[model samples]
Target: MSVRTLPLVFINLGGEMLYILDQRLRAFNTSEDNSEKGVWSENDRKRVMNDIVGTLFSKSFMDELLKPQQLYSHRTMKTVLTRLAHTSIMRLNPASMDRLYELMIMAFKHQVFLCPRPKDLLLISYNHIDTIKEFVKDTPVVVNQVNETHRKIIEVYSSLSEGEFQLLRQTLLIFCQDMNIRVSLFLKIKIQNPNGRFAMTTAGPVPHGIDVPGLIRTFDSKGREVRRREFPNGGSYTSPIREGSFELHGDRVIRLGVNMYTADHPEETHTTKTPSVKPNDTPNLLAKEELNLLARLMGSVKAVNMPGAEPGFRINLFNTDQEEDEAGASAGAGESLFGVINIQAMQDEQVATELALIAGQFAEKEEESENQSANKGDELLAMMDDL
Candidate 1:
């Protein structure tokens, strides 16, 4: 017998048959491939997954997605059909047929993609069967929570339709499995109408670490942690406490750096109202009124989550004397900011054991030196005993 052409089967988590239709020919075929003949393995599956990602989320696709609402009626469905030509199974269901149509409509209608707030928080976890939570009354959806005092807002994320959600859930599972940061991460999600949603129906088991958003921490005006300003170092620095928080990374210590603007004299009224300076003129080019406003408005934007930067209350160094360095007119002063790190675990069992050993040594020394006991300083003895 000539090499038997492969017959392919498309199935979902529910064992439902998936088919690709060629309406013109009115023919259906489930072309099984050499996958059953040991050609497809874990690594091969990974390669296929990568190919799906590269093709679907390519830069060109993303750019088109940004303006997805534009009608694509003129463009022939040939391009889309060609991509789906990879699969073949004659027995397709109405769900499968409608699913394909729905996705196409979404792409043509500009509902294919979204840009979520706090960009990095891309995905969230939720029960697959969890029905959308509805409010008691049809109220306006508040996409983000704002803090009036600190002007901080909790990040809002995007939700997906059933089809897009399922696809993403599958793709992300593949993507995260091979990544170094394979730990499951929860994220915020926004819900929109389908192509409702899609996922592995009978395609076997659904992988972990992908879903819609669940219980999230809500923040109010008093909540300050979520609003830490990121400070970019090694560049020209602006003098606005509104300039936000300095970026602290790597193995560097957190230090306080402040500068005063002399030209800005809110304490002394300006004889003539100064015009706004060119942004290039100087970093500290605020008018006296603006300067006073900035100083008053510099309501310490503290970091909510970042360690060592939470006590991050803003200060106007201009009003206070600059703690000059050993070398006058140097870059800036570096004083360590305290209470940023949680070191409770640092005093572990080993630390307690070490302290006990030291105290024992001190007690023995005190006994050996009888005459020295007469000179036992209360402060030193108390310190040793405490240790």
Candidate 2:
């Protein structure tokens, strides 16, 4: 009896081949030691493989490949590739080795690993290796590759020693945060997986890591880890303060000297409550200085501060109206800017004094004239009585 051969296939295109990732499934099988429930069997895998082969050879797929989106930056290219890696539509062309190489080079060049895991494959690219080698100048390529598995692998190689592990982690975190923001634009739907592992079943639309409420609870339940130490010059440090300072969450004012503690602390301490401000008081003195900015906009400050004018210097001018019946009072002059501002409005005392003096002189002259007229009228009346 002749033995039937189950065609053994290895699409050896350095990291771009994801659709036919039977090898990853095999690795998972070896590690898990149990077949995932609902997982495709060997026969199903063969069928899917045949479907993939069909699409790769099809003219439609080739058209789409030729009409790739025009992307400006390496970051944008990475986003495009990451989306493609997650998509199930693209059929893997096993025979087109050149095309496969092109895809792999594109993926590796752009740090596509920062994206979510590719389905059915554990992809690693040569570009990542080159990047790692460049980052750790004196390290061997093998060591750089292994370092991904064990991040602290730098300690093992004296030639590749870095200044501090914490610094590297911080740099990596900042880099990832920035890249993630850029990548988020392309992610039409967020795919979540707990622990980045599937226990024989894919959790659809699930987020990676613990849920928000659970994470909050876990943090609340954790014990308070206090860090207190004595520094030189009788200085003391507390974990909460250090944590806040390290995180750069407090006021940014620079203090000059040792008495800086008093300078640095807000009026109210040991509470999250913002200190109550007086109706006009400002917490930031520099903010109060900004009121002077209004002066600049309005023109000279000296014009705003001239001394008040005396009421005598002021004139109460009026409009005369024809007298009607006694039922209603005549309407005084309607408020006008000229009247409100020049006659009635407050002004310098010297200007007011001059105005009052002028009005008094006019009153005296009118009184003298009335007296002269009355004397003339009495003389005329006496002449008439004598006659």
Candidate 3:
């Protein structure tokens, strides 16, 4: 038996027989001795059959492939089909027949190949019970482990008919949503739908949000350590504070980096109503106003979930001039707008363990030093005797 002459089976990824249409036919004009011509003729026939199968698989075979709805290039579809055709055992089934129709219709509409006669096509549109059972055994549908959001989406798709599934899949592709999430919800969606990048970039299995107080403590300890190391002499280099807090409650916008833009006294007095600023200028003015409003709203709260540089909160470096021994030395000088703090956002589980360890060391060391300093010579001698 020749490899070229062997009966070819057309199967989907699930190993279901879509249909058995035509035998590999040779061109009447080609000689068997002309290997190039014979090979060419055989390849051409296989390609046509592949296109027919691809069209049947698409949503509206005709509309999905031919109309503006089709996104893939005709050439791309050919490559996809050629690859799919490599699988063994085409199982006949209601699902397979339905998919074949979609693929064929799409291919025909796209003019990927000349449409074949129904007679020439030899449509084997019967359900292969054995193949169906095997397919069910071998290819069970599974939801991707990372995408929980898609689990809900698939439930909605389960009620849809095959045609509806195809249409919905196409719609998801057009709208630029996660097809994996969509497909996991609906088993009928193709296994080959492009792997979704949105999920890869944005979604993770980590808990949704973070802890506020814990995060602040972490940043504070870290900042203090860094500051102590850097400024062993105390010139007060300002480091970053918590920028703002996005909590389970809601995000709080911080206002810092303020630049005063009040009119000069003479300009204000002469104010012949400065030609009512144009709408084009309104956006910048509005942005400045909003920043100021945010500053006022957040300014003197004893504590917020987190703190850091905000748009309106400028870090001004005003100095105290009291011969280095002023009674209100800290109070006289401008306070660090972000406060004397550095806060890190606390992520979950593993991070919590790390933070706890570091914090424990610092607390323990401080306690040890304080105890040692409090005990004088006799107390130290007594403690040493007990040891």
TM agreement with the true structure for every prediction: 0.17, 0.18, 0.16
| Prediction-by-prediction clash tally | 36, 14, 32
Candidates' C-alpha lDDT: 0.23, 0.26, 0.26
Tens-digit lDDT track for model 1 on 3-66?
Answer: 1000000001000101111111112112343243322333333333233323322333322323
Best-to-worst TM-score order:
2, 1, 3
Compose the digit string of candidate 2's lDDT tens values, residues 1-387.
001000000111212243214332222222232254433344433333333333222233322222212211222223223223222222222122222223333222222222222210112222222332332344344343334423322222223223332332233233232221111101111211222211122222122331212112122346764443433422222223111111111342211100111212221111011132223221333322332332233233133236672111100001111211111131122112123235577799999999999999987885565444333323322222222
At residue 305, give the lDDT of candidate 3: 25
lDDT of candidate model 1 versus the reference: 0.23
| lDDT, model 1, position 251 | 38
- Consecutive 10-residue window with the lowest summed lDDT within model 2: 1-10
lDDT of 3 by residue, 215-251 (tens): 2222364456332222132222232233321111123
How far is 374's C-alpha from truth in model 1 (Å)? 99
Which parts of model 1 are misplaced by more than 4 Å? 1-35, 71-387
**Worst 10-residue lDDT window, candidate 3:** 1-10
